[model samples]
Target: MKKIWQLGFLLTMAFVLLVGCNQSETQKLSTGKSEKTTQTTDKTATYPMTVKDALGNEVEFKEEPKKIVSLIPSNTEILFALGLDDKIVGVSDNDDYPKAATKKEKVGDMEFNVEKVLSLKPDVVFAHESSAKMVESGLQQLKDAGITVFVVKNAASFEETYDTIKQLGQITNQPQKADQIVAGMKVKVKEVQDKVANVKQRTAFVETSGEPEIYTAGKGTFMQEIFDLANIKNVVDDQSGWFKIDPEQIVKRNPDTIIVMEDEKYFPNIVEKVKQRQGFDSITAVKNNAVVKVDQNLTARTGPRLAEGLEEVAKAVYPEAFK
Candidate 1:
């Protein structure tokens, strides 16, 4: 009787042990599955990037930055457009975009006070390659102390401007958004071109940077790109992009129209002033009263509003045809 009872107890204990073991195995399988899912998610989060600048500098961008500092006025505008204004830690004194940029703490004047920039402790600093010699060394010193400084090429033409915006969008992890903005601009520019496609082309001169001898806007400039779409001949050889031309050069080219880079403060009454210049009556632009005024800001800068700038140029060049 005693042996039978002992055997029965042993059997009951064996059953309990088996039940616990099964529960433990089930939990182990569930935990393993959770780990596998986590690893798969992490594996696909690849975001290393590379880019090139106008100065032929190959830039390798590897991480998403939380804090950025811009050293140029144009860069400030671009940064805000890329949805980085909130992350921007510092800006140049002249940054006036999004209106909020005006209130941010300024590191320093565009090319002044390197120490102020270092004090901001920016994760990344954006500068112009053209001014690299003036500021790149200071930036490198900050880089050596574990900072990242990036230089963007200054774009002189419309295509380069588009490329710069596209590249910046990638850096900010907003490539799709950047392309959308650029695509809209291309559409607007094309509309103007298609309108003037059949218009009678005209010869012209575009003066840039007010001067004693007119320094005209020519090829490789935003003004020239607009002029091309307007189907106007830039009388001064666009060979050197821009050069000084006297009244004789103007009459010799015999441009049908002349457009001055106007400053409201300086050339308030351009029509009367242009009429009084010596030997000006012989020129077609002066004779037909085809002289027009254009804002210096719209004609020069590369910004989101450039499409509107192109519109102003196209209309000024061929008012009747565009209408």
Candidate 2:
């Protein structure tokens, strides 16, 4: 009787051990499945993001874009700044900065070649407001081909410029970087502002184009905003937007400083040209030899480098501040 009782006890103990081992294996498999689920959730993007571009059109992206094409130089600069260079498959002919852009496949300027853009298989294409207008039909066709096209409006103010940068960052999953860029720009602009705080605001003229017809920046233009930030009053602030100013009108304004956009091919020796303008000799800028030549791209392109233009203008307008 004692031997039979011991055998029963040993068998019961073996059964309990076997059950515990099976449960352990099942728990290990469950844990592995849970970890794999979490990883998959992390990799998937929350999609179907909808945004209204500068043209007031609602644009939607089904998923995060992996390939892109920039139709304007400003957009290209913004993309490059956001560290999306590898994603940019094509750029406009005018995209010369960041040097790397020049080597990308060129989709025709102004009027984009839909065929070339399609051949690159870009998930999204950025177009300027003017360029979109120029190729509305082509854009519609691209949209019909299931391609997403976003038209960036011309940013006339610093706030608008920041909005564009942030919007692009959101589209590309780099909003943090976008914010950093804008913050850096703000800091630089504030530094310039601080340097010119007590300085008296002077009247200045921005010569956009010269010769038979003189194009100047007026109110609601980036140049005017830069002028305002630099503690200078735009001599043509009375007019609205970009307009041609008669030589006689410029002479009448008689600005204290003249900033000419340098385009050697079109307006070489622009400073000398301004000095020789019939009746411009009496102007304060010419008399003081304050005809400063600035890079056209820096002043004109509404991208990450705008603050640099602002700083250049401040230094040009007030040399004593730096001294």
Candidate 3:
């Protein structure tokens, strides 16, 4: 009777161990499935997606693009910032940033080469809203060839720029990277704003060109928005858009500082040229030696470096505040 009882006890112990081993294996499989589900949910976009462009045309992507062509420098810069450099097969002739972009196959400047772009067999091509009308025929040709073309909006404000980045991120399946870039931009902008918050506001005049035809950024322009954010007043705020301003008119405005965006390669000694202009010596900026030169690309291009442009402008205008 005692031997039979011991045998029964051993059998029960073996059965309990076997049940515990099966439960452990089942839990492991369940955890792995849950992890895969989370990964799928984290993706910003899925395959066979459709998106609307600035021209109100819908373009569909069967899958994430493996090859891309950017027709504008700004779009190329944004793409590079999103870690899509490896995917870029062609770029505009004017794309000079990121160093590597300069080595890409050129598809022409303002007028892109449809044949060249077609030869690349890109999965998608990025166009800009500013040149949409000018390149309407080329874009249509691309569409007729069954190539996907997305017209990015001409971003005029930081918020609009952020939207562009986010849209591209979703389109390229780099939504997380796009969000991180935008967050960093916002932080930099806020830091500059906070730095100048206690500083006294000063009036400024921004010159985009000089000599034969002088031009300045006025109201309804991106530079005006930058000026506002930097806590600096635009002397030409009364005017709208980029318009020619007489040297005499600048004299009359008597701005506290002057910012020039002309490249030295095209306009050498531009700062001194501004100071030596007839009757400019009497201006406050010229007298105080406050004429500053900033990179045209940084100030003009609507890309990832726009916040850097703002910081450069703010620092140039208010050096004391930054110190």
Give the number of the best model, judged by lDDT. 3
Off by over 4 Å in 2: 1-45
lDDT of 3 by residue, 92-167 (tens): 9878999999999999867789999999999999998777777899999999999999998777577777777877
Candidate 2 colliding pairs: none
Over the stretch 1-323, how does candidate 1's per-residue lDDT look in tens digits? 32232222222322322222111000001121232211111112224544444345544456766788888766777778777878898887756666989987897763546687778777778886545666666777877877777777565555656666666666676667677777888898888888778878888787653446466644544456567766878875445445556767776787788887655455567656776777788888888888878764564546565776777777776788666
Q: Can you give the lDDT of residue 142 in candidate 2?
A: 91
Model 3: how large is the Cα RMSD against the reference?
22.3
lDDT of model 1 at residue 208? 52
Cα-based lDDT for every prediction: 0.63, 0.75, 0.79
Q: Write the per-residue lDDT of candidate 2 for residues 43-103, one digit (tens) a residue.
A: 1224555656657786777677899999888899999999998999999876898989999
- Cα RMSDs of all predictions? 24.9, 24.1, 22.3
Candidate 1 vs 3: which has more lDDT: 3
Listed in order, each prediction's TM-score against the native is: 0.74, 0.83, 0.86
Instruction: Return the lDDT, model 3, position 290.
Output: 95
lDDT ranking from best candidate downward = 3, 2, 1
Q: Please give the distance, in angstroms, between residue 218's alpha carbon in candidate 1 and its true position after superposition.
A: 3.5
Q: Sorted on TM-score, highest at the top, how do the candidates line up?
A: 3, 2, 1
- The residue pairs found clashing in candidate 3 are none
